[model samples]
Every structure is written in structure tokens, then in C-alpha cells.
Target: MSINLSEPIKIVFNEIEIDDYLPSIKFKIDINIKQFTHLLTYSGEIWIDCKVWDRFSKGLNEGKDTTLNDMDDIFIIEIIKNNEFIEFTWSIKRKDPEGNVMTAGYSSKITDDVYSVIRNEFINYPKWW
Candidate 1:
């Protein structure tokens, strides 16, 4: 489904599983922006102590640029605030046939509400330690 730029961007973490003995989490990030929707399944460990989400939240609150990537560098998200709009970029890297590395990304200018929603999503993410 397509999301309007005026509306808050959607970010959801699903299929969450925490490691029993490690401070790591495994989940899929389902993100929707404008007309693009992607479900990124992260097979690599996401360390809780990294505080990536917290950094994103702080950056959003302070109107600064923030870039976050999975441990394996499979998924990357970048957010930059410009004037009254927020520039958001989401990219994925994968190896194509013949071991060729390829990257695909989508970018859009969104409203402040989108930034707030994303910031809260990170700030309130459950910490299941």
C-alpha cells in the first residue's frame, strides 16, 4: 500500500526474537514510505548495547542527520532534516548473480510528523534483555 508523504511514516518490527544468552535481537523491519514498502529481514545480530535506535532518536529530536545500518550492512537508513521537510533514504545491499554487489534505495521528502513517528518508534522500542 502507498503512504502519503503528509502522513507519518510507518516503521514496525516484527517476528522479534531475542537471544537467550546474547545481548542481541533478530527481527524484520517493515517500513512504508510514500509508495514504497519493504520488509527487511535481518539475519545478523543486532546488539542492544549499540544503542543505534537511541542515537536515531536523539538525532531526530535535535534535527541532525542520522544513519543506521544492520550489523551485516544488509540494510541502511539515513535521515536528514532540511528546512521544513525531512529527507529519508532507505537502502539495501545484496550480492547479485556472479557475486556482483548491488544496492537499491528509495528517497523522499516527508513531513515533521513522519520524523516524530519514527523517532518515537526508536525511543520506545521494547528492550527485552
Candidate 2:
């Protein structure tokens, strides 16, 4: 039997809403991962302070590992550089109707180009308030 490696993680920024009373932006995030012929997807809405994005970018530029999460802890993304590859991890947490917390996540290692992909996405993200 042969082992299969997962595809590079994909992140898409959907609709965005800037809070009028706060320095935060609320937006929808869509994450997709494909392994062989199987596709896994997760989408959720999260609010994040405007400054966090800037800080995240700076950290990446400095070659430091970084982790970003929504204000509510509902979604989280962690990126770490390992030699010539980047380790990407994402997780989602939610509560069932019975109030029990459920969590799911996935991690993969992809080419260092992932850093450029993320930077481009953030730079071109919707900015209308």
C-alpha cells in the first residue's frame, strides 16, 4: 500500500462586514482541503480586529510562525515554517444543540509558496467598510 499526501490547503475570504461601532471586521471564511479524490470543506463567519491582520502579516514577513483565530475562538489557523515546507493547520470548534463542544481540524505540509499565497490573499481581500 502507498501513502497519500494531502493537497495544499485553500482559503477563501467570502462576504465581509465592518462593524460601525467597533474596530473589527466580520467576514466569512471558506477552507477547502483535497486528498486523493476526497474533498473536505468548512465555512464559518468570524469577527477579527483590523489590527490583527496587520500584525499577522508582519509576523509572516519576519519568518516567525503565527497563529490566527476569530474573536470567538470558533476558527483558528496556524502556520509554521519547516525547512523548505510550511506546515498548515486549521481547526473549527462549535457547540452542539446539547451544549457539548465539538472540534475538528486538519494539518498538512505544503511548499513554501503558501506564504506568498496567503500574503496575496490578504492584500487583495475586500476592504470596503
Candidate 3:
């Protein structure tokens, strides 16, 4: 789907906030779109698994983790299209201790071009952002 890959774009992981001990980790991601876009406004949130969260928190407290790159978190993106909010989601999965996969997996409705742009933004971060 021919996205303008050359257009300048920026994606930054701003801050992490935890709401509860059911322990949802709230993150703010900003995508600076300086080029083509059909979206009016964009926002996103991701939830990390408890195990991953423990690891993340431990690393944070220990002041060692550089980035959230090694996480298998669920990512959710929302866009204002046609004056309405449309939600999209993507996730990573892995086998459990019992050799069974566990997750309330998700799906997304965003187009290939949009997904490509978003993925590219993160894939290039920490090195080129």
C-alpha cells in the first residue's frame, strides 16, 4: 500500500503510569505526523503482562533497562477518522510454563500503510529517532 516512507515521522515513548495493581501500566506514545495522514487525532496505549511488568519495573528500579524493546506487550492505537474514534490493536505471544499459549489476543482494523508507518517508527527508534 505505498505509504510515504520518506516523510519525516517521530514516535516517542513518553512516560509510564500505573493505574492499579490489577496493575495496569499506562504509557503515552506520541507520533509526530508531519506528512500525509487521514487521521484527525491519534493516540495509543499498551498493556504489558504481569510477568513482563515485573521485569520492566525491576529493571527500572535497578536502573538498567534502556528500552522496552524486549517486551511482548499488547499495543493499542486509536485514530480519529470521519470524526469518530477507530481502535486498532496488535500483540505478541509466547508459550507458558505448561507449553501452552495464554492470552486474550487482539486484532486491528488499521490499513497496511498505517501499520507499516507505525511499525517503522518504533523499529527505527533508540537508534535513529
Candidate 4:
């Protein structure tokens, strides 16, 4: 892959979640290009890609369901190329050794000069509630 030495790519903080939450839990993420997202271009240069996930637990069947816990969910993010697929995986190892999957991680193309805000999942504490 060849990169255009002439084109100066700059990163732009398009989205932010400094004061945000998932469900009721106080979740946060500092999404950045190069630092996180590592999309390789045809020029052999990496595009910006910083992906995040929801840490929400669901379908309660626990002995203690009084409060939502991050110790219960394993949210994730995934990435893929043109024909390849980016995938995120969810698993619960704390609750159960053979954890259950909640949802496929949300993934997107890594690119510079762009950013996004992802909601971290948390059960019980909803923005609505």
C-alpha cells in the first residue's frame, strides 16, 4: 500500500461522550484515530478507527439482580476489511464460566479525520428511567 505523502491528514474530534452513561452506569470512552482505529489504506497507511460497545446486561436470571454490574457483561467491538467483516462479541464470564453472548459488537471502518460516540450498555439505569 502506498500513501500520498502530499496529503496531510488531520484528526477531528467529531464526537464526544465526556458526560455519558449506558443505561444507568457511568460509562465513558476516548475515541481517537491511530490510537485505536487502525484501518490500513491501499497506500499501506492506517485509517482512523476507534470502536466501542454497550456494556449492558440483559435477560436477568441472576441470584443478585438488585444492581447492574459491569462484572457481568463482556461487550466488545470488531472490525473488517472490504470483503472481510468486522465483528464484536459479547460474553459473560463472571456470571457464568460458560458465559452467554449478548450482542454482536458494533464495528465500523477505521478512518482518519472522523470520530464517533458509542453508548456503553448498563442495565437498570436508563436515561428514560
Candidate 5:
């Protein structure tokens, strides 16, 4: 396969999930390149506020499901290319038990830049479409 260096790269958070009942949710984030041929995946435990999880789970139980569907869900996934390697971040948000907000994100030379682009694309894509 041929690779295009001039192509604007975009990383997409294909899916994200938080396990219920765990004091710290064991979450998994799935990522993929928009136009390239790479699949990035991350899994780890994130500390989340019990109240927040309860509320979210409650909503899900009430039929207010908000599962991520690749075609319709909007995520921040812009590639930041560097000489060493790709650096990116994820848009996952978690509220610590102390009410502090933390993002389920990562970045490094070995990782792809996952920070969202908040330019025209942000306005064009709704949270849920």
C-alpha cells in the first residue's frame, strides 16, 4: 500500500466504555486512523466519581442510551506529526471522586496525536448525529 505524507491525518475514537459497579471503572478506548491503515487501542482503569457513574448508569437504564456509533458520534482526533513520533490525546472525560475532572487521554512518540480539532469540523459535527 502507498502512504500519502501530505494527507491531513485524523484519528477517530471509535468507541469508549466504562464498566459499572467498579470503584474505578475499567475503561477501554478504541481509535483508528481516518484515511490511513492503523488501528490504535487503549485500555486502562480510570478513577471516576461514584455519583457520576450512578447518574450515567441510571440514565442508560431509563433507555437514554448514548453508545458511540462511529458513523454518527463526533470525537476529537487530529494527528500531530513530529520528527520523533505521533503525539495525540483522547476526549474521554472522567470526574474523580473528589470532583476533579480527568481526561482519558495519552500522547507520546509511539502514539498518534488524538487531540481533537475544534475548527470548522467541530461545528459541522454534532455530538450525536
Candidate 6:
């Protein structure tokens, strides 16, 4: 699949580009779209496993008529040193006339080898921008 971005964000770790949003994809978690945040330069909250939900961004869509929830494209995670240049990708979900997400994507790192749901319910651990 072709990758696209509304804003070409670069992953700048410690003032270096370790990876960009359009880099080698590891794996995409099947997290509900609603739980995502639009974090780009902020740190995230710590999960129960101590893994922190770091940052995120509104992703770029490649194909036309593609909504954020389509989940056909893989969301790229540009792991970097400096949080300011970390690359991320997401879709534009809900919006008002001015075009703003009622909610945004946040970072949540997988603490343990968790492959199942946590607490049997979806959680929205707030991320700071």
C-alpha cells in the first residue's frame, strides 16, 4: 500500500533521525481508532505496565474516500530520541466546522507481552501536549 502524510513529520532522536514515519514498519496494533491521540511533541501517561503512552499525530491518508477508521493502512511510528522530531501517522476522525478532533491520539507503549485486552475494557490514558 502507498503511504501518505498531511504533514511530513520526522523522527529526531537526540537531534538525529533514527526513523521517519515512512520507515520500516514493525507491527500495527488493532487498537480502536477512538482510543488514539494526535500527539506529536508531548510526553504521554504511564500505563499499568509502566510503559508510557508517549505521543501521536493525525495520520495521512493515501487513497481517496479513506476515513481514519479504515485501518487498511499501517500507522508508522518513528522512534526517535528527541520527542520534538518523532514521526507518527494517523487519520482525521471526527471534526467540527473548523475541523478538530473531539479527541486526539496519544502514545501507549506495550509494557509487557500483552496480546489481549487490558482490564477487559478500553482505556484512554491522557497524553500531554
Candidates 1 and 5, the one with greater lDDT: 1
Q: Candidate 4: list runs displaced more than 4 Å.
A: 1-25, 28-73, 77-100, 115-129
Error of 5 at 36 (Å): 7.6
What tens-digit string does per-residue lDDT give for candidate 4 at 6-119?
Answer: 112221212222223332222322222232466322111111211111212222112111212232334222222233432222122223456653332223443222211111
TM-scores for candidates 1 onward, in order:
0.67, 0.77, 0.27, 0.20, 0.27, 0.19
lDDT of 3 by residue, 16-121 (tens): 6554555444456544444344432234545444445444334434433222422344342222223233234323344667888733323334454664454454
User: How many residue pairs collide in each prediction?
Assistant: 0, 0, 1, 15, 6, 15
Q: Looking at model 6, report the run of 10 residues with the lowest lDDT sum.
A: 57-66
Candidate 3 Cα misplacement greater than 4 A, ranges: 1-8, 19-24, 36-41, 50-129
- Order the candidate numbers by lDDT, best to worst: 2, 1, 3, 5, 6, 4
- lDDT (CA) per prediction: 0.61, 0.69, 0.39, 0.24, 0.34, 0.25
Scored by lDDT, the top model is: 2
- How many clashes would you count in candidate 3? 1
- Can you tell me which runs of candidate 5 are displaced by over 4 Å? 1-36, 65-90, 93-129
Model 6 residue 61 lDDT?
A: 15
Kindly report which residue pairs in candidate 5 clash with one another: 76-116, 87-113, 88-113, 88-114, 89-114, 89-115
Error of 3 at 102 (Å): 26
Candidate 5 C-alpha lDDT tens digits along 29-61: 333334346544433333333344344334333
Candidate 4 versus the native: TM-score?
0.20
Model 2, residue 121: distance off in Å is 2.1
lDDT of 4: 0.24
Indicate the worst ten consecutive residues by lDDT in candidate 5.
1-10
